[model samples]
Target chain A: MLDAAIVLANFVVIPALSYGSLLALGALGVTLVYAVLRFANFAHGDTMSVATMMAIYCTWWLQSLGIDFIRPLPTALLAIPFAALGTVGLLLVIDRLVYRHYRQAKAPPITLVIVSVGVMLILHGLSRMIIGVDEQRFFDGGRFIVSAGEFKEWSGLKEGLAIKSTQVIAIVSAVTLMAYLFYFLQRTRTGKAMRAFADNEELALLSGIRPQKIVTSCWILVAVLAAVSGTVYGLDKVYKPFTYFQLLLPIFAAAVVGGMGSPVGAILGGYLIAFSEIGLTYAFKRVAGHLLPPSWVPDGLLQLISTDYKFAVSFTILVAVLLLRPTGLFRGQAS
Target chain B: MSGRDRVYFVLCLLLIIGVGIFQSWNVALTMINFALISAILSLGLNIQWGFGGLFNVGIMGFVALGGLAVVVVSAPPVEEAWRAGGWRVLSALFVAVLAIGGSLFVWKRWRPKKYGAVSLVVFLTMAFVLYRFLFDPAVLAIEKVNPALSGFLGGFNLPVLLAWPVGGLLAAAAAMMIGHIALGLRSDYLAIATLAIAEVLVAILKHEEWLTRGVKNVTGLPRPVPYEVDLQQSIWFQEWASQLGIDGIEASSLTVKLCYMVLLIIVLALIFTLCQRALNSPWGRMMRAIRDNERAASVMGKDVKRRHLQIFVLGSAVFGIAGAMMTTLDGQFIPSSYQPLRFTFLIWIMVIVGGSGNNWGAVLGGLLIWFLWIQVEPIGLATIDFLTKPLHPTSPLRVHLIDSAAHMRYVMMGLFLLLVLRFRPQGLIPER
Candidate 1:
């Protein structure tokens, strides 16, 4: 039973928690834009990619300059702030060029969304052109926080549970960032203005909230989120442009599931989606073997669905949430 | 058509002829064939987006379903795999579907009755266990029959042309299922939901080895037109080729492409006429009314949701037909080939730039955009090479720029799209 518990924890819990954090960060960006801008930013994934690509180049440049001062952790950690700045500039320019036009024109939200699709294509092209389309692993940090051998020896358990340093950093950073975001939204003046604008734009404007300033601040925060999440995710796994784009689906799913525009729900929805995705597709033959009698061992892998169906799992949960609770768990202001 | 539209078409023809002059007739013909397919896809999208104001970005999914329909229709059945475990596999599927259907039926019928929910849960658990018990073994047997060659159940060996209509039906069905779930909500929900469904369909295609051979791919689907080798072997073909003063091989391939073009043009004209008629009809006017103002149309008792659903299905069917046509052209069904950027967003650009509400505009956009989509890489590459001439040969930035120049087309295409959206929102050939 203990062995089974260990296996379950090793396979499902830790991975899901880390993955959930990544989704939370990505969803936070999408949610913020949806709330303030009143349009689903289809280009969020590509924005993340552009930021992560910048981070990757920064890391390479730093490594070349012999700036390996952060020995135990990835040097890329230090490069993230620079990437965030670049992202803020990119997004602002995009907004000024593309979105600002539609916003000024008083176009419908869907039309704005369509413009974002065009933006998505441009960013996608830019990222590919700069980074090239291949998987790049830039993590030169300590490989593991808890190696399977170390755990096995330390605990004297048959099952070995390995925990990577990247995963730990990802979860910790995600929590830290999310905490700061929550604090900012709940307590800060600018955050309040932004929230007021999102809630009722005309009323907020009448109440002396500067709409342009609020939109600008929102985009800045969104850029920060996109940069941090994109880099953290890249650090945890490898950076692939297409993979980053695919992340848009699950992020949207999380944002929608948690209730769009609700920060708390984005976090909750992130973990929900991550747990369900990992828990459902994970094959349990070994874990089952540990618990069951030798004679009653299962012949098959005991997986409900295959791993390739990962995207489908996210969609299923999204659809189910839409059907059962259209507004989401936290009662977000859904379209 | 206006003189401006005529000019646009004439320019497109000149461009094709120029490609034929500089490149080859084969390339030009290939361009024309694909442009027709793209136009068909654009027309389908224009129906949903332009005619009915539905924003569906899941064109890739329906197209994939159409491609899948081709494999399911034309590919010969793997008899050995079938004998090994096909019936058993079928039965297992039947049982699983029945269990879910039965549960839903019971849930709906006795929602107010005591113990209804409990009974449903209890019944589902047993049903699932029984299903896995039956399904796991059958799948293992089928996969073991011929893992190298024919591991999965193949299609009904039907005529290739038949696959187009069948593919359309399949895509319509998919659109219906997806629409039933997503429609009647905010318009954006349809966009996201359809996007997710498209991804799901592609995922199913990529992984379900039992269905369309998964990523291994189903190739060499029997062509409706004569094979080039057969044409080369015929005595009369060689004489005809000599008379035409072209090589037998070159002439035969061109003949095949011409045949394909004829067939594609026929289908394109048929769809264009249908869409043109629909656009001008009372039905089309009503769709435009709903699009322009849904609240007013609903107040007028126009059944907005039903009409949206209707157009959504019709458009998806058109996408599916084009998908099958594409598969026929390629002579294979490669599930991995359906990328959202190419199949979904690019087509959206075509429809937008072509004048969404006009059939001729769509065709013109299809031809023009497809030409650019094909030509942009080369153009970008040559331009990059020329610009980078001043840089040293071994410079990393220069080498990287040259090597990655192919991606510039994306940037160029995006800029073009943005430019059109900003400057010419109505597209090159505006609807009358």
Candidate 2:
């Protein structure tokens, strides 16, 4: 039974939690954009790519400067603030260049969505041109909190748990940032103004909220989340622009499943999707062995589906939610 | 068409003629073939976005389905693989479908009460067990047969041309299924749903090696046009080539390409004329009315969602047909090559740049954008080289700039899209 618990925790729970946090961060940005901009930001993933690329360059520069102040942690953690500021500037530029025209013109949501696709293409190309289309691993400092062999020796168990330092950092940082975001949204005056604007633009404007300030703040927050999430995801896995693009589906699924504009819903939806995907792909034979009698144990590996179809899990859940609860699992601002 | 439309067509003609004059007839023919296919895809998307105001970012999925139809309709069946597990696999799918259908029927009939729910659960459990019992072993058996070569059931061994309409029908069916679920909601929901479905469809094609051979790729699909090699061996062809002072090989390849071009032209002309008539008819006017004011149309009892579904399916069918033709042109089914950037967004660019809500605009946009999409690399390369001439010959920056010239199309095309969206939202050809 302990072996089964260890196996599940090692394979399914740890990875899902790590991945879920990354997705939650991504989904938060998407949801915020959906709330304020009134359109799905198709470029959201590519923005993440651009921000991650910026973080990567920052890491390289810091390394060149011989600045490994955070030795136990990846230098990327130190570089993130710089990357966040850079990303914020880039997003503001993009907003001014492309989106402001549409927003000011009072275009429909679909037109803005298409406009975002245009932004996506440009950002996608810029990232590729600057960085090239190859996977880059930038992890430095500690590789793991507990190596597999060390874990086995310490626990005296057959199943070994290799806990990654990056995973822990991703989760902790994400939670910290999320806490701060919640506090900001609930307690800060600017946050209230932004929410009011998102809830009803006319009402907020009539109430003397500066529309420009709220929009700018929303973009800045989105930029920070995009940078942090992209950096965390890159550190956990590796940075690949194409892989970042593929994240659009899951991140958007999280946003829509959680309710497109709801922060809390986005976080929960991320965990739900991550758990479903990992659980579905993981072989359950060992767990079954611990739970079932000898005669009842199955012969096959008992994996629900192939790993190649892991992406389908989130899609299936999204469709189910759309059918059963069109507003998403949460009652968001938009129905 | 207006004088401005005529001018755009003339400009496109000049560009094609210039390609033929400078880059050889073969290159021009290749450009024309692909541009025509792009035109078809643009027309399809135009129906959805232009006429109906539906946002579909899933053109890649429909196109892949169409490509899949070509393989399934044209490739000859592998008898050995079929003998092993094809019948069993078919039965398993039938059982699974029946299980879902039966449960749905029961739920609808019994109003979600206790007995009805119990029966549904019991029936589903049994059906699922039976399906797995039959399916798993059969799939394993089928996959085991000549794993390096033909491992699964292939196709109907029909003429490749017949796959075109079949592809359209397949895509239409898929569109209907996706549209039924996605429509009647906020506009972005359809976009998100279609985006997810497109990825799933491509995933299905990529992973179901039993169906599409996965990444191994089903190549050398039977062609509707005569083979260049066959044409090269013919005596009359050699005589014609010599009379035209062209090499036998060049002439034969050109001849083959022309044959493919003629077929493509016929298909495009048919589609274009059909679109023209449809847009001018009362049906088209009603579509425009609904697009212009959905709330008003709904208030008038126009069955807005159903009409959107109709246009969605029609548009997807057109995409499917083009996809089939694209595979036919390439003579392969490469599922992994279907990128949303190329198949979906580039077509979107064409629709917007050419002018949505207009057939001629789609054609013109396809031709002009395809020409630029192909030529942009060379142009970018030369411009970058000239701009960087002040740098040392072996400077890393210059080398990198030249090496990445191919990527400039994305930036250029993106800027082009943005500029057009801002300045000329109606596109080059405005709707009459």
Candidate 3:
């Protein structure tokens, strides 16, 4: 029982938690934009990629400067604020130069979605140009919070649970960020105005809420989320521009599945997708070997789906949700 | 067409001639061939988005399916692999389908209402287990046959020309399934859904080695035109080349290309005329009306969803035809080449720039954007070289700029799309 528990915890639970947190951050940004801006913001993934690239560069600079204080922790956390600022400034400028005119014209949401696709292409090009389309591994710090060898020695167990430092950081920071976001939304004047604007733009406008200010604040929050999530994910995995672009689908699925305009729903949807994806593709041979008697052990690896079909899992869930509940699990505003 | 439209057409001609003069005639002909394919793709998109106002972004999937059809319909079958496990594979697939159909029947007609969902799930699980029992061994058997070269089941050995319409049928069938599930979505949701579906389609093609040879790629598929090597070997071709004062190799290759262009032109002309006639007909007007005001059209008794599905399938069929032509031209089917940016959004940009809701505009956009897409990198590299002429031969900035020039096409395309949307949302050729 302990062996099976350890194996499941190490392989399935830990990985899913870290991945879910990263997805939650990404989905939050996507949902926020959909709520306030009234378009899908297809460029959200590239936005994260660009911001993470900035953070990566900053981390390199900090490392070159011989910053030893963050030697035990990944340096990307320190660089995230700077990256977020840059992203916020860039998004504001984009809004001013491109999206503002369309917003003023009150173009249909579909047109904005198409326009976002254009922005997505431009951002994709810029990120690739800056990063050179090579996979970069910038992780520097403690490799693991609880090393498997140490855990085995300490627990006197055959199965050992290894937890990575990045996983811990991702989960802790994601929780803190969500807590702060919820607090702000529930307690602050600006957050209330933003929520009001998202709920009913016309009513909010009539009530004297400044649309531009709410829009600006929303972009700022989304930028912060994009930077933090992208950096954490990069630290945990590796930074590849195309991977981030591919991540757009699962993140969008998370947002839509959770309910596009709901923050709480986004968080829930993120974990749901992350767990299902990991759970479905994972071969349960090791866990089964531990749990089942030797006489009853199965010959084949007991994976429900292969790892190559990971994207298919997400897509199938998305299509099923869209078909059965167009408004989403949380009953977001219907189109 | 109006006088302005005539001028636009003349300018397009001049641009092609300019390519011929500046580059070689061979390069120009190659561009024209691909431009013709892009035009067909854009016309399909125009019908869906411009005429029907249905946002479909899975163009890559349909196009890839078209390429797949070429392999399936034209490539010679691996007889040994077939003999190994083909019948078993077919039987497994039949059982799986029957299981699904049986489950559905139970859900719809079973007397025990409360146990329907549970029974359906149970049946599906048993079916899945049964499927794996029958299917896995066959797959292993087939894949193990000469694992280096023909490890999987191959296609019917037939004339490649027939793949074109077959590709259309395959794409149309897939589109029907996709459209049925996704047509009711809002525009943005629809876009994401289609994009996801396209990715899934590509994923299947990439992983299903038995169906597509997966990423190993199926090369040397039979072509609609004579092989350049064969043409070069013929005495009649050599005589023709000598008469034209060109070398045998160049003449043969050019002849093959020209043949492809002629075939492509026939397909393009047929589709163009059909699209134009449809756009001018009452059916076309009704589609446009639905697009312009869905609520109003619905009130007036139009089956908006059904119409959207129709246009969606038709557009996908066009993409499939173009995809088959593309594979035929290259004499290969490479699944990895069907990227979302190159195959899907680039076509969208063409449709938007050419002028949606207008077939001629779509054709023009297809031609123009394709030319630009191909030429922009070279132009960027040249501009960078000219600007950095004063720098040292090994200057880092010069090297970096040159290296980055490959990405300039994407940036330029994005900027051009945004500028056009902002300044002239109606596009270069607005609908009449």
Candidate 4:
């Protein structure tokens, strides 16, 4: 039982938690934009990519400047604030130049989505240009929080548990950010104004909530979330522009599943999607072998679906949720 | 056509001719063929969005289905592989379908609330288990046959030209299924749904080796026109080339391309004429009315949902036909090549840029955008090189600038799209 538990925790639980944290952060950004803007920001993924790329660049620059601290953690954590600030500036500029006119014109949501797609393409290209299309690894500190051998020696268990420092950092930072966000939304005047505007634009406007301030504040929060999430995701996995673009689907799924405009729902949806994707695709042969009697051991790898079909799992869940409950599990804004 | 329309048309033609003059004719013709395909795709999208006001973003999936149709219709069947486990595989698929249908039927027909739900779940689980039990063995058996040349079941050997309409039918079938499920969704949700479906379709195409030969690709597809090599070898071809004062190799290849051009032109002309007729007809007017105000139209008994479904299927069929034509032109069907950027969004850009509610505008947009999409990279590279000439050849900045130029087309395309959306949301030729 202990061995099986160890196997499950190592393969499914840890990875899912880290991935869920990353996705929750992304989904929060997406959900926030959807709530405040009344349009799906299709460029959200690329925006994250740009933020992460900025963080990577900042990390490289900091490293070049011989700035080193906190030996076990990546230098990227230190650079995230600068990256978030840069992203905030960039997004505000984009909002002014591209989205502001559409918002003022009261263009239909679909048009805004298309415009966001155009933004996605531009940011996608810009990121590729700035940081060529090659995969970049920026993590420099301690590789593991708990090495498998160390765990084995300490626990005297047949199965060893390995945890990465990045995973711990990702989960901790994401929790901290989410906590701050909830606090802001629940307590702050500006946050309440933003929420009110999202809930009812006309009513909020009549109530003296400035649209421009809310929009600016929304972009600022989204920038911070996107930068932190992108950087953390890159640190956990590997930074690739294409990977971020692909991450869009799972993030969208998480946001939609959690209830598009609900922050709490987005967090829940992120873990749901992350677990389902990882759990469904992972072969259970090893765990089964450990858990089952030799006489009943399966012949095959016991994976429900191939890893190549990981995206399909998320898509299937998304489609199922959309078909069954358009408003999502958390019952966000009704279409 | 109006004077401005004529000018736009001429300008587009001039652009193609410019390519012919500045670049080689072969390159220009290649661009024209692809441009023609893009126009068809744009027309399809225009039908859905302009005529019906439906946002269908799954163009890539329908296009992939069309490519798959070519593979299914033209490729010679692998008898040994089929004999190995094809029957079993077909049975497994039938069972899977029946399982879904059966579970759905039970849910709909059964009145007992608890039992109905429980039975439905049980039936589905059993069906899935049965499907895997049968499917896994059959797939292994079939895949093990040759494993090198033909490990999977191939298509019926038929005239490659037949694949075009067949592809349309396949795409229409897929569109019907997708439309039924997604049409009722809100506009934004529908877009996301369609996008997901397209991604799923491409994912299946990429991974399902038995069906599409996966990423190994199906090359050397039979072509309607004579092979260039074969044409070059013939004495009649040599004499024709000498008369034209062109090299044999160029003449043969050009002749084959011209043949493809003729076929493509016929299809494009047919679709264009039909689309124009449809736009002028009462059906078109009713569709426009429905699009402009769905609530009003629905109150007037327009059957808005049904109409949306009709236009969606029709538009998707057109995409399928174009997909088939593209595969035929390439003489290869590479599943990996069907990307959202190339097959889906690019066409959306064309539709938006050309003119949403205008067929002629769609055609113009298709041609103009495609030409730019192809040319922008080279132009960007040249500009970068020229600007960086003052810098040392080995300068990192110069190298980076030159390298970055390759990506400028995407940025330029995005900027163009935004610029068009901002200044002229109705596009180059606004709807009359």
Candidate 5:
């Protein structure tokens, strides 16, 4: 039972929390874009990765210059602000050059998706061309902050849980960022303008909300959030170009599941998806062992499915949700 | 068409030929192969998106399944693995199909006045048990066979060329299932659903190793083109090449490649002619009318969903055929090799770049963009090398930059796509 609990804590809880945080950040970007831009920005994932890669390089540069930061933490923390600025510039330029034309044309939603697909390919190409296809690991600073064994001793439990320092930082930062975002959306004038536009674009326009400014601000926020999310995720795991491309499905899933344009729903959806993915593949043998008699305990781990099928869990959930509740649980907006 | 129009077409062809001259013949031929496949894919997309205005983002899934269809159709059956786990796997599939059919039947029979009130739970609970009962043991038996290689049942060892049609059939079948359920949904919802389905399909291809050979990959597939080695050794070819004052080996190799190019061109010409005829037909005009205004068309008495389904299936079949062609050309089936960017979105770029509504434009775009996709890597590398030529021989940046240049093609291709979408959404060769 203890062994099972330890594995659950290490694998299920931590991954769920970490991945949830990452998805929340990614979904925030998605939601913000949908609200202001009124189109799904497919290039957002690669934009995140590009920002993270840039930040990672800056971190390395800063380190080489002997301008090191706090121990046990990544240097990307300090460089992220600059990375966000650069990414915002890139996105703004792209918007002006590529998306502005489409906006001017008053293209349909699907056309915008096609245009975004083009943009996504360009960004994908740029990232690959600039960075190369190798899996670049930026891990160097330190190891685990909360050792599993120590947690076991402190809790006075047989099961010990290991939590990486980055995971802790990720969760904390995600919460703080999300809180600030909610406050900004709920409290600020521009935020209100953004929401009004999202709610009723024509009405909001008639009410005097400047569409361009709102759109620009949305891009800035999205860039920052994407940078933070991508960098932190790269730090937590590893940055791979291909993985970012594949991540489009899940990130979109989270956005759709959370109810597009709803921050709270996006956050909730992220956690829901993360839990489904981690929990589905998680074996209940150790957890189940505790409840069952010795004679009745099953042979082999009682895993519902293999870990390799993790993505399937999210897809299944998304399909089921869409089939049952098309607008999602919260019904925040037009899917 | 006017004489000037004919002249312009000739000019475009000349430009393509000029570009091909600089690159190796092998590269040019490879581009032709990709172009044919992509044109077929674009045609499929044209039916759903171009003709029906239905958003079908699951092109990747259909194409991947089509690729898998080739493996399922062509590769020699591993009798031992089949004996080990074939029935179990088939049962799993059977169970899933039955569960789905049964659930739909139940949903229809109950006809609950309010959705999400009661019947949903019943459907889900029954589906879950049926799925688990079928999936779990089938997976286990397959795993028990080899786990590492050939764990799954293999293919039918049929003629490789037939795989193309088989792939199309499979994609059509899969698309019908998806289209039936999703066509009524909003465009965005349909897109999301399709995207998710594609991911699931790819996942199955990657994990269901017993069938696909998984990550180990199935290679050396039978080819319509003569093997390069075999061509090099043919006595008649050597004598003919010597008479022509060319190296026999080189001549024969190029000959084999040229043969492939001819075959691909023939396929493209056939498909293109067929599409042209279809577009001119009343049926095609109806599709376009439907796309331009679905509600209006439906009000006029055309069954919108049914029409959309036909286009969707037709388009997917084209993509399936192309996928099979790609597999045959490579003479290998690599489940892990499929990427949305490489397979799905890249083709989208080709179609958009070519001219979505025009078959000729699609083919042109297919060929041109494929050429650019392959050439951009070399172009980037050469530019970087030239720029860094004066730098230290051992400079780390030099090596890194040179190495990194390989990725520039993706960036270039993407930029090219955006530029085309922005500046010439109609494409260089606009549909007449």
Candidate 6:
């Protein structure tokens, strides 16, 4: 029983944690944009993909220069800071060229959304133009640091557990970043100014907080988060440009399902969405069998649903949340 | 006519003639047809957005439903296929609808303790069993029938023109249902809902092979105009072409395309007239008032929700007619070919560029933007080719750069949109 639990933990729980961490970072980007920009930046997903692709390319270039990491962690980790810087520059340019006019005009929220849609297409086309519409997996490094066989035998258990070393790195990096962000927001003057700006933009402006600086800072932070999250997710899975674009729906769902403007809510919502997607799709046949008596278990009812419908599950939760609490659980202002 | 109007008119004519001279007459005519259809789409959106200020990001869904209406109204019925699995499919649909309706009733009517807890479970269990019972067998039966030509039930054998209005009605009905639930929410939420639902609608169209032939695509849809080949073969056409001092083949093709262009223009004229009348009406005034300020209108006893719903349905109807015409022009109902990126954004660009809240502006925008969309690709390719002329034929950089220019159209479109929004926020023909 304990062995099976360990196996389940290693496979399901650990992966979920990694995914949750990644989604939390992505959600942070989205939530920050919603708070500061006061519109859902649909192009963020594609921007993330572009940043990660840059990092992957740079990592390959660096590795060719014989700058190899001896650890099991992917070399892309070393390339992420450079990727974040590149993304920050890219975002600032987009803001200056495309979004600044709309912001100055004080367009309606929907017009801004339409502008963002245009931005999304431009970014999407740019990414595809540069990278081509192909899945690239350039992050493969050394083998597992702690193989499942080693852990199972170490515990003297019947079922073996596998924990990828990259997964460990992802969780730790995410938590550390999130911690820094919370500290920055709570303890720093600039972060307080950001919060004050988000709380009421007009008031913030009246109080002499420079809107451009705050907006620029928000975009930079969002760019860094998006780049890190995208790199980690691409490393964990595979990076496909279009897949990231499609992921806008679920990521937005996560951010909105929590409250749009609340950073903590975005994190919570990410994990909630991740768990529902994985948990609902997971067949509990083995788990049920372990818990229940032989005769009482139903044959096919153990499988909640096929994983192909995982998107449907996220959408369903979003709809349910919207129907029940339109303002979201955290009561942020509606867009 | 006013000097500005005359000037604008002259500019438009010159642009059209230039397009005709640069491209073939047939290609130009095809662009005009697409433009007219897009005009109808933009007009529909204008009613919702420009008039009522409702954000509907699910135009693609309503368009697909409109196409489905064409299939249902015009395609010849597949008798053998229907006999094989029609009853099963019907039963599945019936059970699904009943489950949903029953659950709604239970939730709304019952005051029992913990009823909410059990109601959802009961509804789901019933739905699953009923779905599996009908779905599995239906799939087998559908496969057993023709398996290739007509593996699913086909449409009613009616005149193809009937599909247009029917398409509008179908789309409007779907819009009404969605709007009824989603209209009360904030605009951003509506955007997300509509976008998700449109994706769902597309998924259904793709997965439900028994209905839409899935990804195989239903083709050879009936056309309102004669085929160019047939025109070429006609003796009357040939004689007229020779009389006009033009090559018979080229004349015939151009004549057939011109016929299609006229038909589209007539449709556009009819829709434009109707839309213009509606926009000038009291209802239109009310919609504008609501759009400009919803709360104010609501306080004035305008029934804001109902008015929004009305515009939503009306706009969806316009989209439906446009969808039908597009499918008719293509002579196919390729569900997979319908993408949000292409269909949705193009129409938006039309509405925004032409001038919202003005029917004439919408049509003009539609025509101009459609022309630009088609022309930009060739222009991009030409520029890339010119730039890469110095490179070797097999050079990777040249190949990569040349291929990448195809995506430059999107960047151009985005730039165009941003420029329009910034410099001329009121559009080419601002609403007077």
> What's the C-alpha lDDT at position B66 in model 1?
94
Off by over 4 Å in 3: B110-112
TM-score (all chains, Cα) for each model: 0.98, 0.98, 0.98, 0.99, 0.93, 0.92
Estimate every model's Cα lDDT from 0 to 1.
0.91, 0.91, 0.91, 0.92, 0.79, 0.81
After superposition, candidate 5 runs with Cα above 4 Å error = A1-7, A139-142, B1-23, B110-149, B229-234
Q: Where does the lowest 10-residue lDDT sum fall in candidate 5 chain B?
A: B1-10
lDDT by residue (B1-432, candidate 5, tens digit) is 446445645764665576668866555666656666676777777666666677777788888787787788878787777776677778777877877787677678676566643776677677776766766776667667765656667788888778888998998998888787677777777877887888888888888776787788887677777887876677887788889898876787678767777877787777778888888899989989888888899999999889888888888888787787778877788888877777777777877787777776776667677767777788888998999999996898998898888778777777777778777778766767
Q: What are the per-residue Cα lDDT tens digits for candidate 1 across B117-192?
A: 8989998989888887887777777777678887778899999899999999999998898888888768676678
Q: Model 4: runs farther than 4 Å from truth?
A: none
Q: How large is the C-alpha RMSD of every model relative to the true structure?
A: 1.4, 1.4, 1.3, 1.0, 2.8, 3.0
**Residue-by-residue lDDT tens digits, candidate 6, B1-432:** 246645765676677788789876677777777877888898888888777888887889888888888888888888887888888888888888888888787777763656776877777797878787787688778856776686768899788888988988988888888887778888888888777777777767776778888788887767767887888888998888888998977887777677767877887888888889888899888889898898899999999988888889999888888888778777788888777777777788888888888777787778788877888888888988998899997899989988887777777787788788778877878877
Q: Candidates sorted by DockQ, descending order?
A: 4, 3, 1, 2, 5, 6
Off by over 4 Å in 1: none
Query: Global lDDT for candidate 3?
Result: 0.91
After the best TM-score superposition of candidate 3, give how far the Cα of residue B339 lies from its true spot, in angstroms: 1.5
The predicted structure with the larger TM-score, 2 or 4, is 4
Error of 6 at B53 (Å): 1.1
Candidate 1 displacement at residue A300 in angstroms: 2.4
Q: lDDT per residue, candidate 6, A147-212, as tens digits?
A: 878977787876777777678777888899899899988899889999999999999999999999
Q: Return the DockQ of model 5.
A: 0.64
lDDT of 4 by residue, B1-432 (tens): 689989998998998899889988999999999999999999999999988889888999999999999999999999988888899889999999999899889999874666988888889989988998888888888778787776778899999999999999999999999898889888888888898999999999998777777888888789999998999899998998999899999988888889999999999999999999999999999999999999999999999999999999999999999999999999998999988878888898999999999999999999999999999999999998999899999999999988898888778889889999999999998888
Tens digit per residue, CA lDDT, model 2, B1-432: 899789989988898899899878899999999999999999999999889999898999999999999999999998887889999999999999898888889889985576887887788889878888898888888878898887767899999999999999999999999988888767888788888889899999998877788898898799998898998888988899999999999998999889999999999999988988999998898899999999999898898988999999999999999999999999999999999889999999999999999888888898889988998888899999999999998999999998888788888888889999999999999787
Report lDDT (Cα) of residue B277, candidate 1: 92
Comparing 1 and 3 on DockQ, the stronger one: 3
